[model samples]
Target: MTALHELTAEAAIRAIEAGETSSLELVDAALERVTSDPWHAFLAVDEDGARERARAIDANGERPPLAGIPVAIKDALSTRDLTTTAGSRILEGFRPVYTATCVERLERAGGIIVGKTNMDEFAMGSSTENSAYGPTRNPWALDRVPGGSSGGAAACVAARQVPLSLGSDTGGSIRQPAALCGCVGIKPTYGAVSRSGLIAFASSLDQVGPLARTVRDAALTLQAIVGRDPLDTTSLEWREPIELPAGERLDGLRVGIISELNGEGIEASVRGAVDSAAATVESLGGAVEQVSLPSVEHSLSTYYLIAPAECSANLARFDGIRYGRAAEGADSLLEHYERTRDEGFGSEVKRRIMLGTFALASGYYDAYYLRAQKVRTLVVEDFARAFERVDVLMSPTSPTTAFPLGERTDDPLSMYLSDVCTIPMSLAGLPALSIPCGFADGLPIGLQLAGPAYSENRLLGVAHALEQALALDQAPPEPA
Candidate 1:
């Protein structure tokens, strides 16, 4: 029998509805696995609460779509009564009074909250090393990083601790980590998922999505949490709820390879796999061609400026006065504020905050932040032009495969380049996903598939086809 922990959320749902597995049985298995993981994928494991939720589901006569399935929420999202640190010590013991809308819906759909996953503090770094709790190691290569911001969410899914988990993407936080960790990650169109109660990173760029071991599982988790919510002004009514497709071929579909994201800076094996994915699309009767998004060359720079500027404004609320952690023994109130923040935020978070503050400062606003915003629009335009020529676009999710932990921690520029391929799609607020494509030296590589805004159904269908063709046996090694 397949271990309950190994079953996909879709399969778990089927079993629960068919009277084959009890929610308590599955929840117990997930808790055992999560608590045992050495990868530090989770920051908190609500073992008792999860078992209680599962028991209640078992007693119910009806089964929800995700009934009995355990899910890990990214630490960045607020879970009422659950520690919601956003992976920073600044908010150490704080818990939100209300859960994030997406999370509220997730529970309403019958998913059990297993734990809160770790992430880069304030979602500012690329390697997950910026996490105040310590970096989440890549499941494939324990010595390497598991990609950042959403690292813990991806790692747990990749480690098979949970069938699905939530992750917030700000400049590839979700997709990049999914690539490194060999799991499937979906970054929905910007407004597709409600952000209310989520710990803000970069409000405009951050989006909540799901990480799963399979395309179908990811789609299932994504649909439950999406739709317009009154709490979030930026939320949009989805075109339609996401429906999973099981077809194995992408016949007559048009897939474009983003020229800029493919060539320079990308690792050889990753590039080969992307080329291979395109060929597989052709074999499935889909047309493949190269399309250019010339403006993406500036994606990295534009992202650093825009994301940080937003972070500065959104994070200002964390000042010593209101909540979380505060400093004492300062000679003055201003000194107190400085001391609190300096002691609270991690180095990377501080760096971005400084950059953002400077960019928004009186003398530099026009030269930096405003210019970055204008450049951001150009990136959006770039995608719009390319999408007109192709129904979907393909690229390497990251420039390289998982690198040794701490390899780029001291070199921030090198770390930022890790998201070079995935950042452009985020800037455009388009739906994109990273599916495990192949491997390099046994390390997983991921191929990114993206589409126009609100085309998640199309992108998911196409990725499902590619995933079938690849048929990678990507399970990570057991903890020793």
Candidate 2:
């Protein structure tokens, strides 16, 4: 018999509704996994609160869609009264009085918050090693990294600690980690999910998304959290809940293989897996063809500029006077800001902050930030043209599978390259999903499917079809 903790969110919900298991049983099982967490996946676990919520649900005879389902929230999402460090020492031990809009919705939908998962500091790094608390290990290989900045959220789900998790994607934070961690992760269309209360990484690029074990599970979670929020001006207006289409047929689907995402940098094994996935799509009666998006090649440069610039502006509020770490004996205000930031931020965070400040500085703003924005428009145009020709686009989520934790730590450039394939869609503000396609060297590889903005339904439908046809079992081996 499968343990309660191993069940997917959908299955757990069904079991709870059928009275086969109580919410307390599922919460206790999840708590046990949290206690035994070998990957440092959780930053804090709300054992007592989780139990109390479980008991309330059990007593009330409530059968909400996600009633009693254990969920791991990435530490960046503010949970009222729960510490939200955003994996930075600066905000360490600080608890928000108000809950993030998405998290509050999840709780209202009956998803029990098990704990706050780890992440890259301020959602900056491609690897979770930049986390102030420490890095989250990939469940597939103890020494390997589960990609970031949503690494902890991905790691928790991969390790079976929780059936569902919420992660913020700023330049592929959610999907990249999902690929490396061997699970399904989705970054909904920009503005599809409200950003209110989610700690900002890049205001325009950051979006809250779901990482789950299956496409249907991800869809269900998205349905519960997605909608208009007056608190977020960027939030889109959509009255109907997102529904996953039934069946695996892609009879009229036109799948476009990203021409630039393949070749040179991608590993042969990773390419093979993507090739297999494409074939699977073709087998499902879908038309597959190669499509070019030239501006995609410039995405990395454009993203580094725009993302860091926004991060610099957004992170300015954490100068110690307001909240977070404060310098103890600073005689001057300037000295206070300097000392507090110096002590609070990690090396990667500082690097990006400096880069952003430099880019946005008067002398160089036009040459750097403005040019990047113009190029961003071109990238968006590229996607628009491609969508006119193809129904959806596909590629390997990352050039390779999970790499050793310390493998690229010293080389930030190499670390940034890991997100090259996923960043372009982010620049275009399109909806994309990453699902396990196959494995290479016993580690999972991800196949990414992206579509035009507000086309999550089509993207998920095609991905679900490929998922069923490929039938790749992504269960990571038991943690060592």
Candidate 3:
């Protein structure tokens, strides 16, 4: 019998249903893995809660789709059992009274909440080094970084600490780290998954998605998470599930290769990996065409302005009184807020808060924030127009693979550029995914596939086809 730790969520459910494994055994295995290198991924481990949930499920013999399977919820999401720090000192002991809607959904699907994973402070940085708790080392190469702000979540899944994990991607948080760690990650359409309990970095851009080891696993997790939520007004209800045809040959699939994603600023090895994957798609009967998203040039600038503006607003609620750390010697409420926030927020978080505050300020709102919003519309329209020509869009998940920790941290501009390829889609609120394509310098690389809004099923299908052809048996980096 396969050990519970080695099984996928789908496989775990089947095994439990078939009486092949007990929920306790699976939960214990996950707990053991988490305990083995607690620093690498988790911020908190709800061992007692997890075991109790597992025992309850085992007794009922009611295995929801992922019954008894362990899942690592990104620290950005609130959980009553665990501290929901956004990887910052400001939220060190902050635990929400209510669980996130997605967390509730995972429970309904029979998933055991293993723990909360670390991240870049408030999901601001590209590397997990920004985490107030310290960087999450790549499971593959201990010296290198696990990409962020979903780095810990991806690391947990890739390292086999859990079969599946949740991440909130404002930029490439989910996909980039998954690629770096040789795991599968999907950023569902914006608003496809509720953001009710997620710590807001960029409210309009942030989205919750899954990271797993396989396309099927990612799809399974997506199915469990996707749905409308009354709590989140942004959430939408699709009439039906986005189910791509299984075993469907990629022959004749219309794939658009974004010309802009290639050349200039792309690493030769990364380019080669993308080319090889594209060729694999061609061999499998998929036609790759050179399509352009002209507005992509403005994506970064628009994102910088828009994201910070929202971040400033959403984060204002963290004024030290209701949550996290508090500053001393404040006679006034405003003074208390300033002192608490100043003390609680990390440098990166402060940087964003200031930039966002400035952008939304009365004098600059028209020039910066409003202009960015207009450009956002254009960015979205660009994809809408491109999707008219192709079923899916392709790009490299990042310009480069996982860099050494702190390689780009000092240079915030360069670090922000790491998410260049991803923010455009997020601005457009479209579904995109990053799958492990190949390796460069023994480090894993990822190829991105995006689709129209609410086209997660189609994107997953396309990703599945590519995964089949690539036959990438990407193993997680051994823990240091």
Candidate 4:
């Protein structure tokens, strides 16, 4: 018999509906594993609350799709009554009065919130090292990092502490970690999911997504949380609910390989895995061809400028005046602001904030920020043109497998390059997913699939077909 903690969310729901398992049993099993978490995947655990909710659901005999499923939520999302830190010291110990819309919807659908997972402070870094609390180690290799800023969410699923989790992707936070951790993660089209209660980090780029052990589990999680919310003005309105495709064959599908992503900089092993995935897609009766998105070359540079600029403006709210930690014994208001921020934010957060402030400064504004926006437009146009030629695009999620922790902490450029293949799709506000394709020296390599806006159903369906055909074993080795 399989451990209850290792069951996928979809399977757990089935067990509950069949009367073979109770909600309390699942929550208890998950909580036990969480308590013994050696990777530091969780920041806080809500044992009492989770127990109460489980007991109520078991008593009511109403099993929703995720009725008894236990899920780990990224700390970036606000949870009422639970501290929502965004993994920063400044907002430490602060609880939101209202839960984030995505989280609320998940609970309403009967998913149990097991606890909050750790992340990079304000979702800034590619590796989980930027987290103020501490770094989250990859379950496969304890010395290596679980990619971030959604490292905790990915780690929990890969470690089997829970089969489903929620993560936020802004320039590859969710997908990169999923690839490194050997799980499935999806970043939905921007505005397809509400961002009302999520702590802002590059507001235009941040979108809530799901990370799970399987493709079907990820799709079901997305179905439960995606919808328009009145609180978020950017949320998209849709009359029909999104549905996962029931079919597995890609008889007439067209797949595109971005030319710019294949050349130099990508590791040989990573490239080889992508080629294999493309071959699998072709074998599934789909047409595969090379396509160009020239402006994608400038994605890293443009993303650094635009994302930091927006992060600088959005993070200005945490000046100790509103909520969060305030400095004690400040002689004047100016001193108070300086001390509060200096103590609250981590080194990486401070660096980006300074870079953003400099970019948006009076004389440099037109030269840096405005120019980056123009290049962003070109990148978006590049994707639009490529999509006209092909139905979907595929690439390596990262240039390499998980690297040793602290390997690139001093080399910020190397860390930024980790997200190179992922940022272009984010800039275009498209739906993208990362699925385990193969392994390199015992580490998993991810194959990323991306499509035009609001094309999640087709994207996931194609990925599911590839997943079935490749039949790669994604289980991580026992934690060290």
lDDT of 1 by residue, 370-395 (tens): 99999989999988888788999999
Q: Each candidate's TM vs. the true structure?
A: 0.99, 0.99, 0.97, 0.98
lDDT of 2: 0.92
Instruction: After superposing candidate 4 on the true structure, give the runs of residues whose Cα lies further than 4 Å from its correct spot.
Output: none
Give the lowest summed-lDDT range of ten residues in model 2. Answer: 238-247
Query: lDDT: which candidate is best?
Result: 2
Model 3 lDDT tens row, 33-72: 9978644788888999999998998899665778888889
Model 4 residue 98 CA deviation in Å: 1.1
Q: Rank the candidates by lDDT, best first.
A: 2, 4, 1, 3
Task: Write down the TM-score for model 3.
Answer: 0.97
Report lDDT (Cα) of residue 291, candidate 3.
92
Cα lDDT listed for each candidate: 0.91, 0.92, 0.87, 0.91
Off by over 4 Å in 3: none
Determine the backbone clash count of candidate 2.
Answer: 0
Enumerate residue pairs that collide in model 4. none
Q: How much does each candidate deviate from the true structure in C-alpha RMSD? A: 0.9, 0.9, 1.4, 1.0
